[model samples]
Target: MTNHTVRPRSAGALAAVLAATALVTLGAAAPASASGPACPTDTIIDGSRLASISPECSFAGDQVNVGGVVMSIPNPGASVRASSAVAAGYQDVPDVVVYRAGNGGVAAVAGDQEFGSEGTLAALRSENSAVAASARPSAVSTLDSAPVVPGCDDRTAYKLSGEKWAGAYEWSYNNTGSPVTSGVARIQDALDTVTGGVTRCGSDVDLTATHRYLGTSTNSVDVTKAGGCSEGDDRSTIGWGELSSKYLATTCSWSQDGIIVSSDIKFNNRAPWWDNTGRACQGKTYDLQGTATHEAGHVFGLDHVAPATHQVMKPASDPCEYSQEKLGAGDAEGLKRLYG
Candidate 1:
């Protein structure tokens, strides 16, 4: 058996704003208290080749290996044909699995193998055949299509009122224009400029929202780590001060009578590695305000900023100087696509 890597372009992949390592764990749309839904196992396809596979740390802290290998079964959405094309009615079946590319590899075993309908077998194979095993596999299901991303669908807009922004943070965040408090205001101001001072999307569309908050002193679960922002070498040479472990990233969705939007998260502290002049670790510090502005875009469902720069949504920050705090033309276009 041979392992083939699959790499299909996600509708949301282009809009993903966080680093490749960052996992934007928004508050589930079901409710803040809602328990995570079990990974569905309905569309298990048997007799497929191991096309692509990735490892993901589940919410339960268990490591789940998801694969995008080939399947003998037809893709759920498309007309059965030799040519690969996603079907008309088929939304991708989330959490599907392909087997390891080796002898004695099992066929369609439950839990071990999850399934996604990649239009056609050939298309799925073509898109993913070269995916590397080392890359962290993202969720196969429509996690990207979730109604609640940071910048999608005017989700973050509703949270931008002076009151809403002020309320989400601690008392210390109230200073007039101090670097920290002022950073918070600048982020809000940028959002206000982009959204035209509107807090809600009047029509049915992708919504976005963003806000700032103080972080915990320390926690095993931190956004900076989960989003893989602090661990990479890019941050070290970029001259960010330090990475704070307490920073949090969360997205929440709400839908009862057809209301949907989500918020983004950003941190405002330094990483311990920032002080180490010897370049001990691959770390970076950032302008809390600027990073927040970018992460906010993501929570609202925006991807990374194209033509990357010091702009809010760019994956890596430039050296110590935080210049591009304002949203750029690309940022505005993304916001409009999601909302306006």
Candidate 2:
């Protein structure tokens, strides 16, 4: 995948829109409750050390926990309205309290920090519900067509000796914060979709096993708090090959690629994201499989197409749309030309 910049709507603006929409549909939204077994203290992001016999060592202690992790206050304060809780500590008096699930683990809440345990729990549930409602398919609108760019074949498309290599390539996922469990499967599916669908290329490209590799390289997809509407993006780069006898060098691996997906965005496969008027599109989230499929196209050498074309290579897509999970005619044509 080549690096192409396509900025989506700002995070702050998107949040506001979602918040307003959520308010209107709150009556119909599912009830949120804080009901689950006590989370492990080891997963909490608290600063205090608990003694072995300390009664305060539990999740119900001073530390706030969510999804089996202790939530930390955001540093430098958050500007987004949704982050009011985490931004409370910024001022002399903590007005709003916000907590994060360590290393952007997709859990965050904001409310009055001084509230009692019951109040805090209620606030957490409300915040989670509002956030969920805001991310619905109806909350997002498609953008205009993406600007055209040079296709993969135009430049170097990660090939060697004028031939796209055919073999199993090893890949690893960054499991530092939110462990890469199901995400790995999503990525694999995307890779297979492109390789198998593009039969015209013969057996020029095939991605094999994805295992746990402790070693670091440019080629990997890691999750972190990337502040933007875009779900994920990747960059494909080239490296120098072996030294030539005639004192010349050739391009080598098209393997130095980096992919990063936003931890802020919730990804799922549930459908019917939007209401009939397309106004109450809550509950539905972005499909990780579909988005990964598109990103994998870039890994296998594909570029962004105009949204009007409805190609998987289109620059942008809404949360509930999964049509891109499979290759479109335009997408297949492009792959055939390059791989064939």
Candidate 3:
């Protein structure tokens, strides 16, 4: 499988706040126990030895099975979030894709990865025999819409399918070698804040974390540490999340499969703008919970709101500001529209 890497937008003021560092590449393959059933030979990529094994197999090198389909990545050690949507009978034919974005908030490539050979209409009919014959045409024509936060520029949104997650989603932190002291707790709190805010929309969709450990690798959200002080200097953005791209048409919701937060930036829970006189006008630490909350919003469906402070989805976060930790009116409205 061929891999493509796109650079995210530049980090502006964040550069002044934290020192820069080289990007850490993550490419370890998932163990053999993680492999699923073997797939047909035709489904494998050309010129790759992966055709001999199960589609779920993660090769010794940079190749790994994402949602039962093999994918190649630039950095084998980078965390991956893989998801798939398959029709019946063609259990071997998986409509899946893997996506990755730099630290900057730029969007992920939509049509970059290839799935498989384009089969004839008769082949589709035969493959989906279990599906209602009458519904076959619609199924064939239906294309999953790209999973993207609604308000950001089209360029920065991750090109994934809008696959809504069911029930309360779980999240865990991989803080090994992380610089932040309370990284796990702080990020969990931020996720909770965002989930609670969206719940106010009266939607059934929610997020919860019962454990901090990385358990069975399925659809759970994994919050990992990134090596960057500013958004684009060290990495591409302050943080970015990956979602499944094959299930977009079923629902307009995209399951936030993974997130990476930069450790180079300074963050604190203290309120912003407090003076030396103990008055509220002179503090400078960015709110960690607030930043997490913003990133969580992206995991959901909200995008960056312009003018900086109109809502939690603002494109750029101001240092020492906590207004985004809570959902704004616009944020609530977006959730209601998507989930309600």
Candidate 4:
């Protein structure tokens, strides 16, 4: 199906206002737990490695068992549409983290790092709850508007605080256990819509960025079945897998120094995926294109606003709402700020 939306204009003004708001809010927010038994000072001193370690490792011995990628998670919110717990809301886990362990030591869990996790993630959330609450919306982008759109104020959006595609990310597809009825074309179209050169509402929006599909991949996505990040083949992959009930699909991205290095998109095998955009929205079944479009936004560095805000970037999905296949005015505007 074709994508369409209201034409987008510059949201630089709104972005600036929201950014300034964040600066002030963070400055005033209380500090999260820094040192304690859960995270002793001897281990990177801040417990950044808590989420990826196993029970036996004692937060130091196991070390996520990945290739030197030490992860630290701290978000007191169940969020980004994918927020909450690894059990109830795996989306709360941060999709990207600072990749500077060698020189920077266990990267001091950035107060601004929106996504975070550590195994069960319960401790991480409580540890940072006050700080996270304090940093809530000091201001948001409401300058751009198209009330006809789902999120009436397309400006109600946010992007990953750090790391975006420094170049066009050539990704691969994996369909080993997909539940998509429409087959590969439908999924491919979704990927293309997100990468760049999409038209909305007969209006061409500047949604171009570096998200490309390099054909099918033999590897599975690095996202865990529980909806947390995992160390996989290191290939940027988009494919099918088991995800928690809360997510239509889960995305995990890896970055190095403010540049997106790789990412994985996993469509839930449990979801009854309907790919025919021409058809009406169905019960329980979600639009593959629409939902995947949102997951792709996360891959390309978009963050979730609130669901009530009503943009594609909202953290929750409404079954059968195919309009999400196209970037809303706010979605486009956010991309413009990052990629343009």
Q: Against the hidden reference, what TM-scores do the models get?
A: 0.33, 0.32, 0.37, 0.62
Highest lDDT: which candidate? 4
Q: Candidate 3 regions off by >4 Å?
A: 1-161, 198-284
Over 1-340, each residue of candidate 1 has an lDDT whose tens digit, in order, gives 1232222122232233222314322211111112221221212222332222111101111111223322222112111000010111222222122222222122232223433323333333432332222122222121124224333222222111000121122211222212232444554544444344122122222233333444322222111222221111111011112222333222111111111222223242333212213333233443443444444454343443322222344444433323334454344444444343
Q: Is candidate 3 or candidate 4 better by lDDT?
A: 4
Quote the lDDT for 30 in model 3: 17
Order of quality (TM-score): 4, 3, 1, 2
**Where does model 1 exceed 4 Å of error?**
1-190, 197-224, 228-261, 264-268, 272-285, 307-311
Clashes of 1: 57
Candidate 4 wrong stretches, greater than 4 Å? 1-100, 107-146, 197-202, 277-280
Give the candidates in order of lDDT, highest first: 4, 3, 2, 1
Tell me the lDDT of candidate 2. Answer: 0.31
Clashes of each: 57, 6, 24, 21
Model 2 per-residue lDDT tens digits across residues 1-340: 1232221123432343344444322112111213221122222323222111121112221223322223332321111111100011122111122322222112232222322243333434454344333321321011112213222122112211111223333444443322223554565566577765532122122223121222323433211121111112332221111211211101112211111111111222122222123243344444555666665554444544544565666555556555656665545544454444
Candidate 2 structure, TM-score to reference: 0.32
Error of 1 at 276 (Å): 23
Tens digits of per-residue lDDT, candidate 3, 96-132, equal 2232222211111222343222222122223223222
lDDT, candidate 3, residue 271? 23
